[model samples]
Target: MKYIWIYAVIPVVYSIMFFSVRGGFLKSAHMLNIRFLSGLSIDDGSVRTALLVIFAANIAAAVITVTGHLGSTAEDGYLLREDYNGQTYTQNLELSISGEERPIEIEVAPRSYSETEKEAILSRAAMKIESIILEGQSAGHINQDLKLISSYEEMPIVISWVTDRPDILDWDGKICRGIPEEGTDVVLTASLEWGELEKEVTIPLTIFPKELTGDEALREKVNEAVSSSNNSEDEKLILPDKIDGKNVVWHSAGSGQGLIVLFAGLLFAALFMFSRIQNRDIQEAKRQEALLYDYPHLVNKLVLLLNAGMSMRAAFEKTAHDYRISLKNGGPKREGFDEIL
Candidate 1:
């Protein structure tokens, strides 16, 4: 009931406000220029379109609100369950208990797998560990870090990793410092277990030093220096003045170079746009001058026709008809007389 009232009142109030802004009634649909409604009067088309939109929005809100609250009446400790299959089932649910203003969220899953099925799932997952341990690099020619996972998600299995050469490759698959220039060999062992079943998988990897460009190597040295300075207990923070063999220069975070570049770009764009606007205005002025070039002659002709006993309407038609004939015969266009026609 609360949800229904909240959703229902919102649409009703919105409809009232929308109509109130347009004279407090659904008499016209103003400011809505839909293409399909071009044939109908603007007011009539807008009124009908507004009513249809409001009706659809209110109906959708009501339906969604009502359906969402249908499961609100579920009791504590009650959860819907799926039929048993080979795979595990889990669902996240939010429960509202009596006298509690906030809902309690919990996860529910059905554990109906047999011992035989569990062992088979774990065995397959353990086999996949060796293929993925290299993390896309070839095992015989590895130069990057490995992706040693603590667990496999396909089955209920916990994995623990151990490396024989811990100095070259840590248990977490990170390549530690001091990798030799000629490369070395390392072995990674993964212990996989599910319930009482346990299996071990070993992967042999040849690790070479991670190749770094000049800039990357310099960046690493600077980062190391900055990290080393972080633990100093000196009164003022000391920054590194040199990295490797190159002299280092420290600049404040608020550098003006970026702002200067941005201002220059904006200035160029503004000048270009201003020039375009000036050209447009100049062209419009010339067009207006051309439109009024023969204005005095037209007025004189109109006055003479009037003095010669022709009606004002007849004089205008005659002038318009003559202009049309002239136009068809490749005469220069006069927009002022075209508007009169």
Candidate 2:
């Protein structure tokens, strides 16, 4: 009922604007020189167009707010039954015990399945769990982090994972420190539980060391030597002088030579392009000025030939021939004369 008031404001505002404009409220707008309203009059089409736009925009905003606020309802701190589908959606919810507000994502699934169907889901899930843990590696080459899931969201079962080698791979599937150069074998066990039934799935995996490049290996050695040199109780701090039977040299990394060279190249290219464009524009302007300067003389010659009883075509031909003869005698080159010929 409260949300319905949002729609009522749209009609009331539209009616007021219609009556005010149709009456003479905007008649003084032109005399007052108002920015937008000065161009609108009582009988103008713009008056009707502006009213319709305001009416539409208000109705749209009201509809969006009402639907967004009242889409899902709750009673007594629990969600309404009709709002839950099988897919996920979010709702603003408050916890009764903690008095805390939070937006919770909810997904509801059916719990009633026959015993035969439940067994089939678990059987397929066990086979699927192997690929999920491997995460894209083959069974013989596991070097990165594993994807150990606590629950499978697709099915109804809950899973609890365990590993045999805690040093190589922990319970959270993180690859631990100091992995052996050669591979190590580990067994992962998943305990699957659903309502009252339980099942176990075992996956055997071989874990290998991560491959590192030359630079990465050198940095790792330097880091190990620096970490060993730290003594908290000493007065003076010590830095590592050697790492892995090789000498260590430390320098500050603030050299700007590379950036200086890049900027110099860019500046040179921009200046070269600017000079080329300026030269081309100067040549174009000179050609246009030359043509404009020679236009009056050409027009006078054509008028004199036409007044002496020559036909229009003969006058044009005689003008072109005179321009060519002047060019042969040492007259200045004019673009207009060349175009006439």
Candidate 3:
């Protein structure tokens, strides 16, 4: 009953508070509370919950004293998709933050996949990226990439595909844009191994650019795609908890909010554990009191056995065997055995 109240009340109250803020319940964009909720997400779990509360409090406290000049989005900042060869690419191509208007374009194309190119692709997946690398063929100023890539078709049909090319993959298996075939969604691969590495791995990744909205969903999708290709790299390098062994290291977003959510979740779990311990103690105490009630019946049975042609020693031994068997099979243990000796 106590546990029922704790789990039910805690999440319910938190959920109402969180959602009310999410839906702009009592605040507007100009208000500090609304701004704080925008940076939060419920699905990120409890660490995010704790971190979110702290982050919001911090932001709101600062807003009480600081100025916020950031606007939503600009007119030149629109969404567009480009196609190269047969694959399709979508990007949030935007103009520079400066007074200039020329958009920084992202062209989708298939280049030869190389060891250096894999490293380059992974680097582009990072937050601050300068250039993107293509797999399969060499990258050119769009001209050279297309020219050299077209030759792969003319050479020979070494491998044939049934659907869209791998480069133009949608979120699931759907191909957004690609050279279409009979069915859909096909990636014909003929890979050449390099170095002494016994296994070769292929990873799929989508690139997310910084837009005025700061779309985390888009970034997560792109991250998933890029991670698919990174499986060949084996375990990642362990990030140290301390720098010079003085204090714990920290990450801004991943470790920051994620850690907070984890800790909050632990609090709820600890509360649950305490409840279980208290309940267990109550049960054990009740069980001991119950033993006192069942004792006199055992005494009456023993008295009958001794009076009838049975010896006291034999009666006691027989009763012990029955009690042991009952205990092993989850039956009740005999009462008053403590007083027999």
Candidate 4:
């Protein structure tokens, strides 16, 4: 009987009761000035149908969310359901984070908060802070120099911006009002995060600003300032720009000994190299003239050896030895006799 009530009786009876209801349940109850105990209202046939659909949908969603939260499903596989919330469209109801080995299934529903929820959220925030400290070490907000100041009434939240934005502090924080101590230069820690999400969060430091100064010292110093230009009558000279853009004082002098010495050194080096090259050229010409005379004699000897039916090697050797003897007799020398042969 319980199983029948659970499965068959509940569904059938619930549907029948819904169809047999007289007018709209909400309207009828409101007219009688009676309150209905149900969380959902079956105000009209269409509304009843919508509620039934919503109930089935919420049940399916709750089941899906609970299953995902339990991590009892394949990675490639996922369930789908209508959001039905007019504000939000039918997008994938999954929360994807980078470097996450598992795709996290968040319990997607209407965002609501309670005291218990707020506590849980606070605990989560604490965990996040701990994680940041663990990963960041001293590089995080452990050593930052920041100051915040505001009134005592509102416990002002301060947010520092290291971004390219014009302001040093972004719009995330507000100045608290009516502070007991006049706040000025309150010290706070700054943090910067980078990756899939760019999050810049500051860890609240144990420091606050010093009590505000009423600017009396500055006012007194300004009052005592000597504001007279009494030394303005001193003589001055106007200098002219030189042709080479140098402030060269006018003088009746030509080039100095330093310039002369430099010119002489340059001329001596150039003349010395040129003279050596000219001497080398004269020696080369004389050598070429001597070789020209020796060429004809050497050719005659070779012609005689060829007529005498001698081998080319023997002819060349005989000519080279004869040329050496002629050189010993103070005759003009032939070059590369051994090399040419």
Candidate that would win on lDDT: 2
Best first by lDDT, ranked:
2, 1, 4, 3
TM-score (C-alpha) between model 2 and the true structure: 0.38
Q: Which digits, one per residue and each the tens of the lDDT, describe model 1 over residues 148-170?
A: 77778745678999999989988
Candidate 2 per-residue lDDT over residues 80-191, each given as its tens digit: 4332125444555543447655665654342356788778887888888889778779888788878788777556689988999989888988777678878899898999
User: Model 3: how far is 301 from its true place, Å?
Assistant: 1.5
Candidate 2 segments exceeding 4 Å error: 1-111, 212-219, 227-237, 242-341
lDDT (CA) for every model shown?
Answer: 0.74, 0.76, 0.45, 0.47
In candidate 4, stretches whose alpha carbon ends up further than 4 angstroms from where it belongs are 1-256, 335-341
Model 4 agreement with the true structure over 1-341: per-residue lDDT tens digits: 11222443344544544554455565544544546523354356665675477556655665665555555333445533333231322333344468544434344343334556445544444345433433433322222222232211121223233322212222332233222343223323333221122223444322122223458433333333322212336564333333223344645567598899999999999999999999999998987877777677777888899789888988998887887787789986465453344
Candidate numbers, best TM-score first, in rank order: 1, 2, 4, 3
lDDT value, candidate 2, whole model? 0.76
Any runs in candidate 3 off by more than 4 Å, and if so which? 1-255, 309-311, 321-341
How does each model score on TM-score? 0.39, 0.38, 0.22, 0.23
For residues 1-341, what per-residue lDDT tens digits would candidate 3 score against the true structure?
Answer: 12233444445445555554555534432253456655644443453476468656655644542332122223344333332234555333446457765666455454344666545443333311112224332212111121112113232212211213435443232324222333232232222222321222233333222122346444454455445445656677344443333455556565477788899999989999999999999987876776687677766767888888779888887767667777789986444554453
